[model samples]
Target: MGQVPDLPIRNFEVAGQGPAPPVILVRSMHNLLNDAAQRALRYLDELDARSVAPSAEAVAGLSRFQEPLPETSMEPRDVLALLDQIGSPATVATAGSRFFGFVTGGVLPATLAANWLAAAWDQNASMVVLSPVGAALEDVVLAWLRQLFHLPAGSGGALVTGGTMANFTGIAAARHALLNGVGWDVEAQGLFGAPPITVIVGEEVHVSMLKALGLAGLGRERVVRVPADSQGRMRADKLPKLAGPTLICTQAGNVNSGAFDPVGEICARAHEAGAWVHVDGAFGLWAAAARERKHLVEGVELADSWATDCHKWLNVPHDSGIALVRDEQHLVGAIRSTAAYLVHGEQREPHHHTPEASRRARGIEVWAALRSLGRSGLEDMIERTCRHASRFAQGLRAAGYEILNNVVLNQVLVSFGDDETTRRVIAAIQQDGTCWCGGTVWHGRAVMRISVSSWATRDEDVDRSLAAMIRCARSLGVVKNNS
Candidate 1:
C-alpha cells in the first residue's frame, strides 16, 4: 500500500509473448546475478574463515570449459542457478592467505569495491572527452606512482592490460625511439624497409618480452639472449658493443627467483651504447617503494622505460599494469593514433599516451588501491610478504627440503629430496590445498615456486603453508627421517 503508483519496477518485463521464449532473459539475469554474487561472497567469507590455503578446484573446474558455449539448453539464469547449486558447497579458499601459486595478490576490500564501482560505471578510459574522470584519474595516479617509486620527476606513464601488454607498450616505445634516431618512423612506415633493430634481452627474461617482440613485427629469433648470472641477473659486463638501432631489455625481477639485476650498471652501459633500456619488472618494480627492498631495485629509475604489474606485487585486481617512460614524446609518439571521428582536446588526454583507444576506467581501481594503501601501507605489505617468503623457505629448509633460490624478495624456490620427490611433494601440496605453489624447472631439476604477493597474507598463513609443505615433503618416500 505504501508503494508509489508510478514505480518503474512494476513495468519490467519477465517473459516473452510466445512460448515464453524459453524464459531466457529474466531467468538468465536472475540466476547469473544471484549465483555470481553468492559465489563471490562465499569465497570471501571462506577466505576469512580459513587462514591457510584455499582450494582452487572451482576455478580449475571452470578451466575445463574451453569449448564454445552450449546454446538453447540452459538460459543465463539457469546457469547462474547451477553455479549457485554447485559452487555453494565449495570450501576452496585459495583467494585467502595461503595460496602462493603464481604472483597472486589477495584483493583488498577497497580495491575490490572500487573495481565493482568501475564495472558499474563502465566508463571508457581512452579519451579525456569520453570519460574525464578516467583520464584525470590516470593523470593523477601516474604522478602518484612516479613519486611513490621515486622515479625521475618528469617521467610519463600508461595503464595497460597486464605485464605482457605493459612490456609490449614499453618495448614498442623503445623500438620507436631507436628507429626515430635514424630518421625512420615505425608507426607510420611498417618494419618492411626499416634497418635491422637489435633487441637484446636477458636469458632469464619473461616470455612476454619475446611475445611482445613478435607482436611488434620483430620475430622472436631476432632477439639476442644475453647471459645471466647464477642468480638470474643480466650480465652487465658482457653487453655487446652496438653500432646501430639497439634496444636492451633488462629484468628487474627474475621469474624463477626474486633476484634483481644490476640495473644501474646495465642502464649506464645501455645509455653509453645509445640503446633504449627497458626494464621488465613484472613483479619486482614495486620493490623500489619498499624501504627494505629498495636497494635491490637501485637503478630502476635510471632506466629509459619500465614495466610492472599492479596486480602482482601491489595486490590489486587483474589486468592492471603500469608502464613508465622517461621520454614522454617517445611513449606518446609510439602509441598515439588519430581518428577522423575522435576530436582532439588540448588538455592531457589518457588516450593520446597509451596504445588503447577505448579502454575501461582502470585508473579508478588503481587510484582507490593507492589511496587506501598510501606509502606506509604499501611498504608494510612489501616487507611483510618478503618476510613471509623467507619464513616459508626457512621452514622448508629446516624440514630438509632444498632451498633453490636466494630468497631475496617474495619468491622462494625449493625442492623436496630428489627431482621425483620434489615433484611428488609439489603435487601433494597442490592437492592438499593448504597452499598452492607451481613447479618450475631450475637448472634441469624440478623445483616448487612459492610466490607471496597477497595483501591478505599474514604470518600465520605463512606458517600454515610451510607446515603443509613440510608434511607433504615428509610424506614423499625419498624424504628420510634422519635427514
Candidate 2:
C-alpha cells in the first residue's frame, strides 16, 4: 500500500470566529416542561367553567396562527405562552363535561400523565429492541383488554391510531386470512387476481367501517347490505346465503341509536359458512366490561376479529384504538415486516401486529388507564355514562321533544318538531354555548345527537346541559315549555 501524505491545515481566518462565541448555557428543558405542565393543569382546571363551544372572539382569533413562519427560533416559554393564549381559547372544550358532539371521552388524569411521560421517553414502538418497555406494555395491555372483553385466550392485538385505523387493521387481517385460506397470498401477490371476497354489513353500518373496507382493497359499494330494524339492529333473518371468501362486518354500537346488531346469529351463520367476522365496536365494545351491559355484546367473543377505540369509551387521551384477532398468526402475517437491519426478538414486536412501522408508545397510556381504573372503576364509568344518557332521554321526552332512540347506551338522539325546527334548535343550542351538541340526520329526520362518553360528565352536568338545551329550544319556539 502507498503511504498517503498528511493534509495541510488551512490558515485562512473563518468569519465570526472571534473568541469561540462564549458557550451559551440555556435553561434546562425541565423548566420548559414544567411550564407546559402548569399551563395544561390551569387549562384543565377551567375546562368546566368555560363554554363548550368557543366564543366569537376566540374563533376570530384563529387568524393569529395564519401568519408566515418565523425565520428565527423563539424561546420555548414564549411559544408555550402564545399557544396557551391564542390556541387554547379557540378549542371546543371537548374535554369538559358539557361537550357532547361526538363520542369523545375526556382524558383520564392517569392516562394524561402517562402520555406526558411517554412523550418525554420518546420511544418508537416499532420493535422490542427499539423499546422493550413499549413492547412489553403493549403486550400487557393487549392481554388485559382480552380479559376485559372476554375475548378468546391468546388472541393477538395491536394498538392503532383510532377507530378508523383499528377497523382497517382488523379488516386487513381478515382479508389476508380469508384470501390465504383460498390459496391466495394477499401480502405477496396483491389483490390483482385474488378471488373476490363477499362483504356483508348492516344498512346502518358506520362510515368508518366502510372506509376501512375500501382501504383494505375491498370495494365498499360491493357489500351486501342487511336490513336493520327501527332500532338499527341488523335483521339476522335477512342475511343471504354466505359462500366463497366471505366477511361479515357487524356493528356493536349504532352511532345514532346505540343499538347492537344480532351479532350472535350473524357470527354463528358466518362461521358455519367459513366466513371471517369483524366487529366495529368503536365505543360499544366497552359494554362488555360493564356487568349490566355485557349482554348487549353477547357472542362477540366468537367473532374472528374486533376493533374498538380506547379514546372513545376508555377515557384515555386522544388517538388510541385496539385491533384484536382471534388467530395471532393472521395479524402477524398481514402486517409483519422484514428487513435485514431490523431486530426480531423472542417476545412480541409491536410493529408486527399493527399497520404502522413507527409509532408513539400509545400502549403506555392504555396501560395507565387500565391500571388506574381497575375493573370496577371502568365498569362504573360506563354504567354512569349510560345512566346520564338515559337521564337526557327522559328529560327531553318530558319536555315534549321526540326521543328518537331507545336509551340503550350512552347515546341519545332527540328531535324537535320538524326537520327545520330541530335544526334551528340545534343551532340555537350551539350558539347559546351553555353546552354543545351536534346535529345528525337520522332516518330522514334532522336530530341532535348527544353522546355521553366522558367520565367527567356527572349527573349535575347532564341536568345543566338538559336545562340549557330546553331553554334554547323554548327560545327557538321549538318546544312548548321550558321544563
lDDT of 2 by residue, 117-184 (tens): 99989999999998999999998999999999999878999999999999999999999999999999
lDDT of each: 0.81, 0.90
Q: Model 2 scores what on Cα lDDT?
A: 0.90
**How big is the positional error of residue 179 in model 1, measured in Å on the Cα after superposition?**
0.6
Q: Distance from true position, residue 436, model 1, in Å?
A: 0.3
- Per-residue lDDT of model 1, residues 346-395, tens digit only: 87778777788888888888899889999899999999999999998888
Best by lDDT: 2
Candidate 1 lands at a TM-score of 0.88
